[model samples]
Target chain A: MTKYNLPVGPQHPALKEPASFWFKVEGEVIVDVDIRLGYNHRGIEKACESRNYIQCLYLLERICGICSHAHTTAFAQGVEEILGLEIPARAKYIRVIIAELERIHSHLLWLGVAGHEIGFDTLFMYAWRDRETVLDILELISGNRVNYAMNTIGGVRRDIDQAKREQILGMLDPLAERVKFYTDLVTSEPTCLARLENVAPVPADKAVALGTVGPTARASGIKVDVRRDDPYAAYAEIPFEVITSERGDLLGRAIVRLGEIGESVKIIKYALQNLPEGPLTVKAPRKVAAGEAVSRVEAPRGEDIHYVRADGSDHPERVKVRAPTLANLFAVGESMKGAYVADIPIVIASIDPCFSCTDRMIELVQSRTGTSSVMTWEELREYGIRWYGHGHRS
Target chain B: MCGQEQQRSDLARRDILAELCARFPGEVGEAAAPRPGRAWATVSREVLRPVTEFLLGCGPGAYLSTITAVDTGEEFQAIYHFWVAGTELNLRVRLDRREPAVPSIMDLHPGANFYEREIHDLMGIEVTGRGKLERLAVPDDWPEGHYPLRKDWPGLPGGESA
Candidate 1:
């Protein structure tokens, strides 16, 4: 029995993110996986070094279109630390509201993606339809749906007034009820259960050793969350539960994320109820003092970290962003071992998003896995889904 | 109240500093608690791995979040951001600007794999021990010696120095 190569991505139905993972397949089980990133490299980190502090906020927001606010919040927090600026209490609460709202939007988007991957279009359709509600709220608040440019240097750009607060609060209950509906469907639905349960189980010790973070680690019973581990914005002031599961599989990750949505709603409701009164944006100085700082935020995916170093003029010397997807990449490959080829898409989507891939290059020296593939991305996806659909008798 | 919490974390910072100082002679630099629940220490590149291993051994929560490199004109600073509990302990290792070389902490912290490859790709720092590192963030056709994040390199398309 010779182990052969089965390349799953660069662009495949399972990935869709335009990064390649070359897996060494022995029959149906994945023996070894090599990841190749950088299909969509925007050079944002390089771009951030040249741009001024205020300008960089907008640039950072575009890192991941789905979780744009997470990037800006992390970047803003890091820069503010260097400036030694304490934003108004009102700003912090607004930041929390916006952050949690973004979290809801992101996690829901992930749910839809996961649903689609597992061949259950009903959950996917329902989740995204409800996700539009969050987008609508974001558009109502920040004026743009995707990259809501709400966060600024000292605080957020626009204020959520009394009318706006009530409106935003109005959206939570209905969203929670809908999510609960999906929760029941996810846990009980035979289609979702057959594909997701006990698939890609990773132990807690392996997760910790791999340096996994946020909900992925929490799902594996790692007992960590940046919001609780290192308090930032109003996370220190607002109370919320850090969701976790000891199962450490696709089902466990899904459950942890579904539970977190409810917690995020609670935090947002509290924030609206105790809406602080003060100025929205504090005038920040042009020059940040020469210093260094690291700011971590719990993005919808996991831990979003921004490290800033200022050389005093205007432009920051260096701004390094560690997206949660990057931190969880290793563990994802770790969990993929011994899983059915059919379960690849759902298992990959189980970790939410990845392949905000760095612009990187690699050599492609592959061994033939019985039959070879030189198909387009969509073709490869169709081939994958087609093979898995028929009980792959290798 | 936040200030009091800062002081409490500062006590833990002192313990870390003392541990490093006792282990490595003439390698540790000034340690400061810049803000509450944060600590910064400067160390020479000679003892980067030991310091990282010691920190990782301190607790289960001690994890390498990411590694960042800064070119400050005369020197290139490699900042390793380690998170333990609520505390973020930063160990900044300064490398010479002329030939920036830092020992790779990948063996100690697996999370440092991409971070180190990223540093090697963009900043042109020699991350020794990760033999023949592949490009993580740079393009395939990118020239060998052009480091984008260095201060001298203008952040523009095709403005890379030959």
Candidate 2:
């Protein structure tokens, strides 16, 4: 059998993210895969150097539309550490509430995407329809749904009032029920089980070696959660179990995320009820003393690390972000080695990759020769759906 | 129970600092734990690889979070942030501004591949021993020898050179 090079993207219409994936395949089995990124590199790190700390907060928040709060929270924490400001208790609790809500929204979005990849359109619709509930709560609090802009240098920008807290509490039960339904559907449904179970399985050792984080790592049974490990905000106070599965397959990822949604609901409920009475923010100094700090946040995807270096100025000397998706991309590529061609879409989607946040460099490896016909990204996505559709029909 | 775990990890973190200092006495500099849960130390460039190897040998949980390269107007600093036992142990290696380079830890930690290549691209730090560090984050048309993240970088290739 002749080996074929199938290039999936620098612009995949399915994920709507710019990332080029070149796969070396013999027949239907992928032998090797190389991911070329940087299609969306905007030099946010360099941009942060020129902008003041306040301006950089909003700029870094735009790093990922899904995890905007995570980026900003990490940045703010780093800056606050340099300034030596301990944010108020109420602000920490508010941050936890919003962070858990963001987790709910991100996990739900990934669930719908995963469902769509497996040719389960009904699950996709149901997951996305329920995701709107979390988004509405975010909008209610921060005035915007996607980039909530809820974080500032010293503390959070908004506080959860009694009226809003009661309203949010009222909404949690229905969302929890919806998550329970998803947990059942993915575990027992034939279509989901056939397509997801044992597909592109990444073992626990390989997952850690590759530095995969978040739900991807948890699915492999590596019980590493930044919330529990490195307590930030109210994670130290909140009591929730770290969800993990030893399956290390696509189905394991689904189960881990669905389980996390339940945990997020419980966290939100706990945070709101135990909401402390205090000021929302402290008076943070504009000019930070010459120092450096590293802030880590357990983003919905995984560990989001931010490094900030200040030089006694309003603007920072350097700001470095290691987005969770960047750490997980290589692991995804490794997991694709023995996977079928139809498994590409779901395997790549399994990491819940945010390529725009991870795109920091570009590579031009034009190693394609004759005999290798390039398939457009759209066709490859459709091929994945159709290939799996055959199994559903059978 | 949680406090005891925190104390154990805190001891592990301090032990990491002491272990490095004992192994490479004069090689480590500017070492301090500025706050709880974080520690920083600058190691001579020559011992960067050996220090990293030592840390990785400590345990499987000693993970390299990311490498941050900073152009501090006078010298280039490559800080290796490692997460060990809940503490972020940052190991800094300073390079001369004229010819900035650092040994690659990619062979030991495969996850350091992108972070090393990124420093090579944005900060113009030559990651020695990594065979042909590919262009990871810049445009194909981006000019050679121009690093965007450096302190003295001009706006762009053709723009006024800062």
lDDT agreement with native, every candidate: 0.78, 0.84
- Write the residue-wise lDDT of candidate 2 on B1-162 in tens digits: 465355335334345777778988888998888767788999988889898888777655667888999999999999999987656899999899998989888888888888888899899999999799887778667788889999888668557434
Structural similarity to truth (TM-score) of each candidate: 0.91, 0.93
Candidate 1 CAPRI level: acceptable
Clashing pairs in 1: A10-A19, A10-A20, A38-A358
lDDT of 1 by residue, A19-80 (tens): 56777767677788776666556677878877999899988887778778888999999989
lDDT of 2 at B148: 91
Candidate 2 CAPRI assessment class: acceptable
> What DockQ does every candidate get?
0.42, 0.48
Candidate 2, residue A150: how far the Cα is off, in Å: 1.1
lDDT of 2 by residue, A11-74 (tens): 5322212467878888888899887677677789999999999999999988888888899999
Clashing pairs in 2: A9-A20, A360-B137, A361-B136, A361-B137, A362-B136, A362-B137
Tens digits of per-residue lDDT, candidate 1, B1-162, equal 464355334333335555656877777787887876688889888888888888888766678888888888888989888875456888899888887899888888777787888888888989988777877767677777878888787544565532
Alpha-carbon runs more than 4 Å astray in model 1: A11-18, A354-371, A375-394, B1-19, B22-26, B154-162
Q: Find the candidate with the highest DockQ and give its number.
A: 2
Report the number of the highest-lDDT candidate. 2
